[model samples]
Target: MNKLLEGKRLLITGAARGLGLDFARRACAAGARVVMADILDELVTEEARALAEQGHDATAVRLDLADPDAIDAVAKFAGETLGAVDGLVNCGAIATGIGGPDMCELELDTWDRVATVNVRGTWLMSRAMVPYLAASGRGRIVNIASDTALWGAPRLMAYVASKGAVISMSRSMARELGPKNICVNTLCPGLTLCEATEYVPQDRHDLYVNGRAIAREQVPEDVTGSVLYLLSDLAGFVTGQTLPVNGGFVFN
Candidate 1:
């Protein structure tokens, strides 16, 4: 590893497993001190401990992205223990199960929950950590978005709306934080094969796979490199951009 993030402190949300975990592992390998947080406290702790045992500077925290209080508490804890955060990867999200509901049929509660975690959570997490990021002088933020937002997939209205909000929010944040040298960008991944995606309908999965130019399913690792790049010094001049890592599923 080139240690692109040497001495950097990163706080990644939804890192118990899947793509978030993959990002933590890669960031640590690149010499970052990582704070991996998730709603699943036990899993996050165990994963962090395992990484620590391997000589990685890793810590785990219980974080409920939907709760504003929890977001504040986690931010404070991270700032106190890890010093200023140089990077934040907002990878936390929620998916609407297939055949659940359409836009007109979608329940308000379900929409609220998805938006709370996927959209509001990203906003709150980034808001809470901005002070710390600003203090670092080289802050980097990578918000996880989805290709559905770009293509306007049917049936998954709430999820698509939430991710669309994330992409818009990232661009606004990037513009606002540019003066502080804080790079804010969005990473939109297609129908990736992860634990969360298991709930997606088979027809939907097939649609993504067969329609992709590459005709290959995406793995969690496929998105980590773009994230790593955005968080490194190499991306200092990049901001307010949405980088899709979806294997050509949706082209700009």
Candidate 2:
């Protein structure tokens, strides 16, 4: 009932389902107008419509992170449509399935694709929105990384590498945009039990859960509170830091 994000306009990428959709829901609940962007157009449209039906100001945009032009276009569209975007949550990335072969057996295309979408896409989308966010005066960028990045997981080399890049980029972007009043930070969540992560091996799931300090399954909801805090005014002074939403599995 506090409406932490009141008067804010935010855009979320990869919002078709999973954590991104959860983020959209939480943002709307926090009193922010949300523009959900994802490559899955129809699904994201339904997501946006559902939020609207609930009396929340929400819209959906079809965005492909692989396309530089599409990334820029979507950021522009968000600003024009929402009047101004106060924040952006970079959650879009290629869902490289879990338990792939080791790096030696990993295909070149697989590695490249993950890096392109996860690392480059995050950089470009943040770049495209810089001007508009700066204009908002209290602009915020929350880049979604992974706990895998914090603690290197052997089987997911590409994903771990890509997420590591996201965390590094967040720090650099924070310094670059800080003068303009834009804050950039990275969120590293553990192996959350979401639709996309259902394919993860049970042992891998247990590895995260059992290793966590709290020893419980992580969920989308578990990650939302930190995300909301990062996007709200409470985190205005926070930037260039890696905040883990995992159950104390990894530290800063």
Candidate 3:
């Protein structure tokens, strides 16, 4: 809102809908040019076009995190389209319908799939984008982890495990990328009311609301502010940090 990101160029993954979409919109509104990448090609394209109509610099490209080659291509396209990347929001993951199966009941394939998309995907995407970020001189990387990783939510071991890995990876990346002036951090969000979380049982949602210090259902906005700050100059000195924005549901 304060043009904090003016002239910044960013790449946001999983931006077709949900929190990723909101991040893209808020970044654009804050005066940044962005490339929105997702597996939902058509929807991301439409969303980017709408942002363009609103006088924002935005573009859409399909990115399948499961494919390393696809990740490389999208990284290339985003750098080309934006001319340079000042920040990357790694918000894409296999979150929908990946619940219900307990650790013992969870199939091996399901675990692999979640790791492939959530863990490996985040790593690869970050790997692909580091160059553009290095060129920016003041780059930022925001990896979207989950509060479930901290709380150890049951019956969702794969997703929870992958998010934990993300948090660990971000810390390592911060250490490795610090010399390059790129800040890497992780945001652990609570059970947000989004399209992806629609399958989560109402009982679990109630549990989150009741346990939260704020005593309200989490939304995309609750987490987006942390994202903005991490990507802003104010947070340039901060890296390898984990911020849990789950209404005090869990502390780091």
> How far does residue 70 in candidate 3 sit from its true spot (Å)?
0.4
What would the TM-scores of all predictions be? Answer: 0.97, 0.98, 0.98
lDDT of 2 at 217: 96
Off by over 4 Å in 3: 96-99
Relative to the unseen true structure, what is the C-alpha lDDT of residue 7 in candidate 1, on a scale of 0 to 100?
90
Better of 1 and 2 by TM-score: 2
> What is candidate 3's lDDT per residue for 76-177, written digit by digit as tens?
998888876899999999853534866778888888999999999999999999999999999999999999999998888988999999999999999999
Ranked candidates, highest TM-score first: 2, 3, 1
Candidate 2 yields a Cα-based lDDT of 0.92
Q: Least lDDT summed over 10 consecutive residues: which range in candidate 1?
A: 94-103
Candidate 3 global Cα RMSD: 1.0
lDDT of 1 by residue, 1-252 (tens): 469889999999999988999999999999999999999999999999999999999999999988999999999988987898999999988888865778889999999999999999999999999999999999999999999899999988999999999999999999999998899999999988888778788888888889898998899888888999999989999999998888888997
| Candidate 2 lDDT tens digits, 106-203 | 88999999999999999999999988898899999999999898889987899999999999989999999999999999999999988889789998
Error of 1 at 225 (Å): 0.3
Give the Å shift of residue 55 in candidate 3.
0.6
